[model samples]
Target chain A: MRLRNLGFVLLFVAGFAHADTAPFDLSDAEHIKAGHKRFNKTCAAYCHGFQGSGGRAPALNAPDGLPPEQMFTVITEGRRGAEVMPPWGTSFTPEQIWELIAYIQSLRSTAPAAP
Target chain B: MRLLESIRTSLLSLIATASLAATAAAPSIDQAGSADPTNWPQYHRSYNAWRYSPLEQIDKSNVKHLKVAWIHQPGNITHGLQATPIEIDGVLYYISADNNVWAIQADTGTTLWHYVPKLDPIVKEVFYGSASRGVTVGLGKVFLGTLDGRFIALDQKTGKALWSTQLTDQRNEAGALFSSPPQLAGNVLFGGTTGGDQPTIGKIFAVDAETGARLWTFEIPKDDLKSWPGESRKTAGSSAWMPGTYDPVSDTIYIGTSNAAPDYHPYSRLGNNLYSATVLALDPKTGKIKWHRQEVENDSWDFDSAYEALLLKRDGQDLLVHLNKGGFVYVLEKNTGKIQNVWRYAENLNWTDGIDKKTGKLINPVRPEVEKSKLLCPNLLGARSWNHGAYNPKTGLWYTHGMEVCNYITSAPEEPGPKPINALTLGLEEIRLTDPPGKKADGWFGAFDPITGAQKWKIRYDMPGLCSTLTTSTGLVFTGDMRGNLYAYDGDDGKTLWQFNAGSACRGGPISYSVNGKQYIVIPTGLGSHAPGFLAGAFPGIKDLPGGATLIAFTLE
Candidate 1:
């Protein structure tokens, strides 16, 4: 009986966690500027290149970047196995994470036109 | 019919016994202190970490006739096989990326067995810490330090798991994985983890090789926690990430330590971080420090002293030669960690006005500031990367690769962290590669008088050569480069003897050994490390350089 109740609790938690979009305005200009500063200090110096174009790690501005829901999940709780990346849940606040998402979207929009 | 069967069984038993006796005739790796001409028994070929083979069968005259005998391709080339292969009896053993162990015939590239470790599914540290440098073979068992936090021993004969020991918590500490092979010191084998770049204070542990029991643990950071201010000591890093060499004469294990936390920014960690960027001589039995020497006091440039220590005896004095990534070579007394001499090795050092040659006192060293970009000479690629250089007693010269490059670094303050574990607190806003003061960015491979800092002969490379240099008794020097070309030079005067393009970057160490009277040259070829990616902006061709994982063995035709 307890196992069944626990399974239901897990299902309920999963349902609320999967969101279609971020809580804040990812299209906001100020949000992206704040995130650009954060990304440069942490991510851009080494792993992901400046503007998240790519370095040792994958490019965040690629055309097929992760969706809003998946991006939130990966950033909140790091993903391992083939997709290997560290979690950022404990480091940043929920509001700050949303700002990073906005900056990532901006990078994609500002990427150069292909030949 | 029964009598005939009994006679045949007896004959088979006799043959098996004879084979055992014949193999025993050889000086087993565990019994012998150093690697003989026929076998490469240890990580740096021996406890001293010389990376040199005394075999003279293949010399400069006949090295041109050398041909590729065989090639073994490991299918899982995730980050590329960056291990130096080891040989015992007639079997060659190597650990590829993700801790996959393979045993192949030393003469031919026949695969005998392969051990693939099932790592934790949730650990994200495997990508940057992918390549397993090599494996330890002794006590009739092969030992591997995994990407996750386990030290495992496998049956050397069949490549089966013998025992496993959980050393560190890879989940909590993301960068605390093992990228180097465990070095076996007598009955105990010691291993270190990579927490130098992360927040956790790094640790090194010694374990019993036979039973896989914990012996003792040694932490690189200070015990009193006085070096760091505030709560920074709780997470400040001083990683011990490389294998150390043993000195039987002094009965001590000498190992080097990496840089402090927040590699570039040093506000959090104030005083000279006692043990970071230092070398410690420890008691092998108790794992206690005997003597220690801090190479760089408060190293703010990521200049790790975490390279191998080459033991040598000069004028009846036991001395050790250690090269720091900060572009200087130090000679220390092996018995007691006394700095006998210090000389600059790389020419493009602008981090400091100059260092006192003998006393090693800094002369107006440049300090980084918040939000201000300071162009440091070594950069973090290091004036010299972690890959090793060769010291040949025969030629009386050290063959090494000196990278003449610089990086523009801008520092920024880190927010006070009770932050998440596995988070790197590198206080850097931007790090871009650029050329040095007067020269264009390039690499120089040369032969030099180690003690006097005199260059005998030098060769220039468009891009830096990243492989560990190897020297042999036959007066030949071998090293691999970024463009996949393996060049051999005359150890005496640095003349190009032979060269071969491997079609993939040769980023692993080259070794020499003999099997059944035929000498063999083996080098693991691959290129997927952070150095190549970090250096992409400076070198044009590196952006498109290919990567592969193959063990190529060469023998004279």
Candidate 2:
């Protein structure tokens, strides 16, 4: 009977640990999906091309992909080139920035395998 | 009886004569005072544009305890206020957006008089924007240049118009409109800004101060047929949007010119466009060019040379220092157009390899596939825009805010299909992220070692856009950001001493003055072309910021 009680207790403890780790567990699939949604909504195909290719904007899916922090700074702070890019920090949240990063990461892997 | 009557009549006549003399000797306006520390006269304290005030009441020890004295919210919602108020006696005189001039009590900040010029029926159709940086005072009259290209003189006491004259005939494309205050020497010196993409010519005029008469005009692109007697007549459009500085001792006026028209394409207008991107030294009396140095030759990047040319004397030698839009700080001998030194204040600028020492020519080669997609540093708007910079003789340091960014430009074979429908279409495209991001490979403030052409110190900021700097005798450098925070830094070192949230981006320069033995610093805060686009996203918490104008003054308690 004691042995049976120990098995039941272990199961209860395992369930609690799984629930606690759920919020922190960002699956790769989920991250890429969230990022794709953000890129389509905010940027659209107008500047960044239909598949993160180079056009009026630059190609983001390169070998030396943008660092996560740098990507966040560009979106939040905006780029200063020949003209000025409107900043996104006011319109978007910190979580949204991370989502955009995930989308950029997805583009890197989706690109043709390097030589 | 007859003798006594005659004597009484003579005595009455003598008393009447004495009263008339006393009235004539006193100034017409009681608001006029001479040699008073409480008044700010002329554009930069005096006609010399020194920007130095003798008031030392607000020293470094007491500046920390400064508080707002009186805030005059003009509530003028047309555009930004770029004018520095000129105080005479105890009354302050200034011009605002939409070309409205105002006179206020310096001590109380109460409006005394306001004058609005009657616009011509055709002026409404002009593409000129509404903004008047400031005005000049001399010979008991205040002088101002209008957006529609008219110069007006007004009575100092009452805001009544004395005389107004059309300075530019825009219909013929001779000149467009004035965006800066008219500088006054023995005469009034002023220039104009042109309509974008228009084939307009820019010229500087020296008009008689007392009588509205044109004395002499200096055309930016000299008529080769007239001046040189040979060469073809070249078209040069250099909009002089900022005010020029004058040197009375030499009787010379230093005027800087803007970029050539159809700015993106250099092929449309050939030849080394003479005065388009140059600083010209002219004789104020004759309007003849004494010497000139083209800062940028065949400038394809819309980099204007039209910033303020500050005249200073270093090492007992008269010198002129100007910040060009192409990211270079040029030091030239004021008397002779000799290039003494040149240095890049903004890093990551790949426009030019370097300036040639012997010829003083900027070796800016056309990039490969330039008409295609070519990445260039210090984009067309320039490292620094129209905002003015300040110099402190005591510290021997020059303070200026600059942009450190590159652009990927694809010049079309012909002009673009059509101008962008609105301001949003004129937005910038993001390039590959720069390496070592935190150093503001985008925008920040830099202090230059004037003598050595070395950057003494630099402080990086988040975004890049228009801003101005002001230096004080108290060893403090004051400047603002597009994020609406005004900052005070040490003059010798770029250290942040204090900061105040101005609630709006500051596009105008700040000035310091004194009243009743109290020192005060005044700055204008509002929306204008100088505001950065990223500000809306960077400071989202303050996004719904209303746009208006106000002059805020601070004094030590």
Candidate 3:
């Protein structure tokens, strides 16, 4: 009985933690600005270039990149098995992570036209 | 007739001298203690890993005239070059960022041959990053550990693949990788596996030099928590990521271990977590632990004892010297891991009250509290990261390059999973604490007495000295920074003698060697790795310099 109840609790947590259920506004200008700062300080310089293009890691500003939901999961919980992307949940809150995602999305929108 | 004879005699003497210098010998394993002016054969250029050269061709007075000899830009590897190129017979052998072996002419920056490992889909997907510390050259072959966990041997003369063996499988448990350069001692090659962040248990291996065969393996204790009796510990992270120093006299490999598993939360794994944050004296043949000393017991902060264990001789007594990321320099008996002295090198450190003189263990006062901000000094990146320090036998001083930053570390409750969310948490999410007062500098370069662990002299920098320190018998010391400035200082008094703007962060391995009677100092300028990323968050003054992977060689003009 106890084991079954614990399983239910985990299921409930997982349900609410879905990427679709992510809170806050990705379209917010202030939120995106805040994320840009965080991303540049933590992620941009190491894996991605400071401009969010790419160096050691893949380019983050691709027009048709992963949805914000998948990005949320990858950012929070590092991809297991192929452990390239480390989990940043402990380092940044969900709100801050969403801000970073928004900044990355903005980069895609502002990307220069390919000649 | 007399004038013609004299001219011939002088010319003959000059010709003989040139021949003798050209045929100079490569450094042997037995000659590690004594300084070699010509060759940089080993990782630390010696078995002791002192990183000190007896060559004084470019001394303090003449270092001002040092100029760029040549610059070799490795094509494929883009982000930082970490390999300390080993020189032999006017040929330097080193591995690039992507596991590509390059045999370049030491005199001219001409690439003789390049060997790139063709990886399968599985290896490609799993092999994450590119940053090899260096390669070991001996037994007529150049040896290196691949990022995909493979031990490979290549022909030194021709970049031909001789033997290859898989060291560790990442699929086992989480995964394991090899970034540390393999140390070749006698007939066996010693190497350590990295992946403490992967949360896998750490291990050290001894491989046969002749054939790529596993000789012996030593696993750090999984549950060394003496306080927690009868509890079987599943995972204890103690990765030996850095290349260890070899002591020929003691016949032991001195290597330091990384932090314990579930890093931030010490509540899960209690006790000293013996051998995790400890240095071990292991027999190279059988990989048996002879003696071990735990520096930090129940390490709340991510203080790994994983730095270069330099073997130094003081007053005719052999001693093993190590600088902990936790901000302490320990002097121990080379034969035994008995602590002779321990001293703090960081200017302001509050992670612990201090190390107990009697126990040789840290007086750890701070414990991981759930959701509570615990400000600690000599932050997570460590007072000193894995950047190699140099020991000058002439001055009896050890030069270390490191940071002096602090952090507010807070850990969450333990959770069960492969990569637990709350295992080890960087307290960046917590409320921002004010920087320590008068912290005009975030980095420091220090020279300390290896015998008494006393600070002889030090210099502060706005940015941390990230590159390994290299010293020469000519009373000149060399180190580099994140701002891409390579500096030459007076070894005794720590005075800046000369500087160079390499146009990028020079944080990789810096080594010196002589080819064709010319002394040259080589430094790799590029930026990549975890420390710089941490600095980006902690210090706002830190610059995001452009990416590079160029090896710049310097000599007196």
Candidate 4:
């Protein structure tokens, strides 16, 4: 009876830790930080501008929010109509690319909020 | 005995006097002030095409004290100005966007004369727009190529048109006479650009310099059957967009041509597609092909071999070095078109395993297969694009800004529907962002040994695109990045010597000249082309970058 009780206690602790550690919802800060890091690594400083306010590339943080999946598609699949945007799917990993999408989404609310 | 001795003395005196006069009248090519190193008289400064200026007044020590002297902004966007201005007698002559030829004062940036052509409206619609690379000044005239298939000679002193003749007949829809400046070698030698979706032909014309009469026209594709084969000419629309280099010593003019039209599909055009994406050496006086070497065979990626073929002599042998959009640098014996060496200076290429040295043919087995994405290196822009490369003879180093990246190409299905205007069929599947193995991620200005095709040194940037290379006699190589910062590097070591923030991306090549013994470096800075549009957004520091076109000139204080 004592051994069985000890096993139950250990199982309860393990389940609690698993639930806490799982990535459920990323905060706005986390998303912004993730996006900013990827942009620096991939886009550099001339096309998108220093602050994502748009220079050569289009403004990413407009009021009309970019769909997260569409943003992912654009960055991964690329748009060939006019602007020669090279697709980034082969160069970057899927998880990292998704992080970029999350970060672009975070910019929608705070980009013009303070300015 | 006295009479004979006096005669010998008189003879010696006469010989010495004649030698002195000959030396005074014609100075050697190396002596300063004889040729006036301060004045950039021709495209590459001299007939030898050495971009190096002998002026050393603006050395490394005083270059840091340089300040802006003047700025001339022509607010128009056709194609960002690519022509390096030719300076003659303190006046600078250059072609601006929209085919306007402007003569500006080299010292003050004052506009002296502006010549604009009245082009046909219908012809202009199908054309790739109009822009002048520069004007060739010879025989007391300024020569320029017009947008609507015409070549005009204007008086250098005045902007008035001296004579105008059709280089290509637009009525027959031959092709557009675009930006490549007409090179004059006693005769006006020019080429045409046509790779549009329409069925047009490309030809190089040598017209009489004085009367503007056709001297000779060499059809690029030597296939006789294709000249009038059945319904259409087989070798139609192989454009030669860039200006050809003239070798007066050898009596040859070398021209590099663009790719076959409908650029995505190569199978439509059978055979190697001669002369398209090839470098042809022709007899300037006769317009006969001396020798020709194709850079890319059956080009499907729109890889035009239209960049300048910089002529140089290395190791006591004359060599013609040409850079292709396919990321390969080919060095050929200028006399025979025999390729001496080939090297892949840019990494991340997967199109071909290697080029055969003996045959000068690419060993590309992975032909364009539909649906399967074939990743190719150098992308459509190639390793180097239309920007002019600078050669510094003192160091024997060729400086060029090179792109190091790859793209995935999948052939698009062709439909008979109204071809979308400006429809580029080659779809870029993905951009390989990582720097090639063992190299830095960003683009670089590389100094290469032209003879051996070995990179002497490279100065890498934090950006992907850079303007053309500019070298000065002060041991400096000047280039700019997409982030608006102009850099002057040590031509010997690729070290950053000086930098100036132009507040926008610099699209044109830089030039250095002197006024009143004061040396100045001029660069056209403003909004130009940029790749990977998210670059500014990815780096928040440059988001509100300034966008205004200005010709920034700097001089030593």
Whole-model Cα lDDT per candidate? Answer: 0.76, 0.62, 0.71, 0.64
Q: For model 1, what is the alpha-carbon lDDT of residue A87?
A: 64
- Candidate 4 global TM-score: 0.74
lDDT ranking of the models: 1, 3, 4, 2
Fraction of native A-B contacts kept, per candidate: 0.23, 0.00, 0.02, 0.22
Give, for candidate 3 chain B, the lowest lDDT window spanning 10 residues: B420-429
Write model 2 residue lDDT over B372-415, tens digit each, in one string: 66666675557776776666666767777877655555443232
Candidate 3: C-alpha lDDT: 0.71
List the TM values for chain B, per candidate: 0.92, 0.84, 0.90, 0.85
Off by over 4 Å in 2: A1-115, B1-39, B46-50, B121-125, B172-175, B195-197, B224-235, B367-371, B413-441, B530-546
Chain B, candidate 4: TM-score: 0.85
Which residue segments of model 4 deviate by more than 4 Å? A1-115, B1-36, B169-175, B194-199, B224-236, B413-441, B527-548
Model 3's CAPRI class? incorrect
Query: By descending TM-score, how would the candidates be arranged?
Result: 1, 3, 4, 2
Q: After superposition, how far is residue B424 of candidate 3 from its true place, in Å?
A: 7.2
Give TM-scores for every candidate, taking all chains together and pairing residue i with residue i: 0.88, 0.72, 0.80, 0.74
Interface RMSD measured for model 2: 13.2
Q: What DockQ does candidate 2 have relative to the true complex?
A: 0.02
Best-fitting candidate, scored by DockQ: 1
lDDT of 1 by residue, B419-477 (tens): 44445667777777778877789988988876667889998898988888888878899
Each model's DockQ score: 0.27, 0.02, 0.08, 0.09
